[model samples]
Target: MTTHPLLQALLPLVDDLSRELAEDERYRRLLGTLRALIPCDATALLRLDGEQLIPLAVDGLSPDTLGRRFAIAEHPRFAALLAQRTPTRFAADSELPDPYDGLVEEHVGHLEVHDCLGCPLFIDDRPWGLLTLDSLVPGSFAQNDLDNLEAFARLAAAAVKANQRLLGLARQAEAEQQLAARFREVAGQAGRAELIGQSAAHKRLLAEIDTVAGSDLTVLIEGETGVGKELVAQAIHARSPRARKLLVSINCAALPDQLVESELFGHVRGAFTGASGERSGKFELADGGTLLLDEVGELPLAVQAKLLRVLQSGQLQRLGSDREHRVDVRILAATNRDLAEEVRAGRFRADLYHRLSVYPLVVPPLRERGRDVLLLAGHFLEQSRARLHLRGLRLGGEAQAALLAHDWPGNVRELEHLLGRAALKALARQAERPRILSLEACDLDLAGTAAAAASSVVVAAEPPSAPLNGDLRQALDAYQRQLIQAALTRNADNWAATARELGVDRANLHRLAVRLGLK
Candidate 1:
């Protein structure tokens, strides 16, 4: 006896759903089969995380849609879907706005989605996530279509259950090896007061920190420069049982290579030329507490070997001393460089990298933190007002837009400095003591800097052909002249500001302007 065609097709899909394949590949194949089974313009598999639906696999949505997190409370269609267990279909003319409006990959400049079908997947009688099918044509799905989708949803649920079990087992093993009861105690503590932000990225970071704070595993905090790597270290120390003990910090990059060893581990008298008296290093001072190695990627090879020995046995000897002393300390390292790549490049040791990165925590960049930018800006504004003894300070609408639009390469530190500079600029221009000091877009100076950087790239990429046909020196001079002129215009003809924006000294800028016939 032969089975039905739909059942035959599903047999192979279930067989291929094994632990050997990657989870993302499994989701892609599952969504692909659903698309073939039920003809639709788009299909998406979303995982429910708290109140947000994170796109796991999207077949026909824009690339950016996968990066977006849809909040259930904000979208009526998602709320309606979650309200019931049965497959829910929305009418083409339904007043409720679609969560994925203007997000279809094929339909550019169009926001309306004609037909939508969504089904919630359940595991062990609990809601797990949703499987959605969308069509550009109105009234595309019929009653029978809903039945077919509901069948597919059952298979998807089973696959998700299997995947979750596998993941849970792996997590169990890792937790057993890396964590202890201390982690649970620290997990419940309110996070450090200095690290502020309520975005999803921020919350996720805090959660990761809390989970690992109780453990003695070495943690490597990685992120871009000025992304608050130090703040993360402080949070870990504050949450740990070692909070009462000292938290000693050392910046590897700040000290010379010859002195890095003495700074990290104590040195005895007569160890080096400058060793006047025996001194206790950061590691010794931080005994029974935590030690933070900031910019640890800059450690020399010789020091890295000694550091690895101490990490392994918790025993270290002072320079020029044979006696070894045992210390109890938790190691926390932070860096902006990719240590794995550094290890591969021969600049860092692989063994030390493995020793330090038992648990790695990443701090999210400022641009990815969403509306947290506004919150941080407001915080910085208040700080500036307090420091300057101003009556009041606030960002104008245009200034807020500029802050949101700019891609902050320097992260939180950059934002704070920019806000401080803008506040001072605004106060300088104010003739009277106003009730509220307002910072305008011009005061921020971000628009000019952003435009200048963008235009410089464009100008560099394609120079004028007419001028290039002349003397090579003249064409070079002309290009230089154009760049300076643009910077001058952006800075409103202020020579010092123009020089600063162009990254040249005021005297050098004046000399260049004269040589280029712009003086």
Candidate 2:
């Protein structure tokens, strides 16, 4: 007996659903098949994550829709869908707000979906997520359509379960073989780069990290040198679904221009003069994981072009190789340089900059993070105390004032190093063994700095503002003189230390000091 064409079409879909290997491919094909079978305007599959529904695969929705996380309490439609067992269809004129309003890609300008159908999926008799179909036309779904959708929902659940089981086994095997000592070392380093601040700035940064971590978006982290951009990258990786996999980091600036391409894309044997063996690149190593490109603004133009192609297509060919390999890597690019300005100056590729900055996260400087300075100082003090074998360590009131007043040009790293130096100095000066090691303002060596003295200056004389005449050059000269003098005082006339603190060469700083009549 011959089977019907509808059954014939569906048999292949079911077979494909059972045999597909990649989870993303399976989801894409599953959604495609459902849309073909049900004739819906839009369809989405969401997975339950804690109290939120995370979009796994979406068809006919806005690109940004997949990046969104719908909280159960925030969306009444999703809440209603989860509350019921059977397929729930909302009327075209239902009063309840649609979670995906204005989110459909094709329809713009506050478009409200007229009809909606949702069915919750289950695995092993427990709730997993939901499959949703939406239409712009009124009453588009009939009873038969609902029934068909319900049946398809069952098949989708089976496909999801099978795919998850396969993933579990594959991950188990990969974990067993790939969790080497290098992974442990990287994990430990990531653990140490914690975001430790309670200020509003810090809270906002943390919130941004949490929101973007779950999605496979390319993130660009911009900040000044030593502002803890790597820590932000680490936090994103730790919070992502790929947290179990390796997070490979490469410093673009540290590598020579000649070797940057080879380091990033790897090379086969005989690719270069010293190409002794075939090797996997960072992109390959970071497959199913994340790759952090530190100081990405430093990449050569040729390498940047290649990087852009790989990012766009997820395809790369090793050096001197004809065959192309596919990799799945979520990229996180970081730099202290202003890439936008670099693009304008022709120093960086504009296309590459746009590609890398799909999601930009800026780490606030230490000076802007107000009261967080003390909290971070306390943290660093404890670390120093333990590392330096001190009995007890505490910042004195004057020391706290000095810390709050300092500009912290080098940010958290400078703060950490300063605390370490202060602790050592305090320990050395203590002739008798004191029960509590106290770090005073003098011990911090910031007495003559502009920041330290600003707190004590009379308001009328200094005013903490530019001069009324607005003589920009004169004002800058005065400010530079103050900074140089403060650095010299803090360093006890040690020009090298002063130059280091000011981030200038020793001879240059000395020349500037002499020019300003500070000799």
lDDT of 2 by residue, 1-519 (tens): 999655664675689765846776888888888888777678999987557787778898754355455668756889999998779999998987776655555554336688999999988888889999998878888998788777888888888888878768435434433433234465555223357665689889988997998899999998877789998987788777777777899999899998998899999999999999898899998988899999998899999999999999999988879889999999999988778867876879999999999999999989889877876776677566556655346666668788988777568887887888889899999898664577889988753333433322112222334443345444545666666666677779876567667665343355456757888
Error of 1 at 405 (Å): 0.9
TM-scores for candidates 1 onward, in order:
0.53, 0.54
Please count the clashing residue pairs in each candidate, in the order shown: 1, 0
The lDDT for every candidate, in the order shown, is 0.77, 0.77
- Name the candidate that leads on TM-score: 2
* Quality of model 2 by C-alpha lDDT: 0.77
TM-score, predicted candidate 1 vs. hidden true structure: 0.53
Model 1 segments more than 4 A misplaced:
1-193, 451-519
Task: Write model 1 residue lDDT over 390-487, tens digit each, in one string.
Answer: 53456666777888877775689888888888888888887976545767899999855544433442232334435445654455566666777776
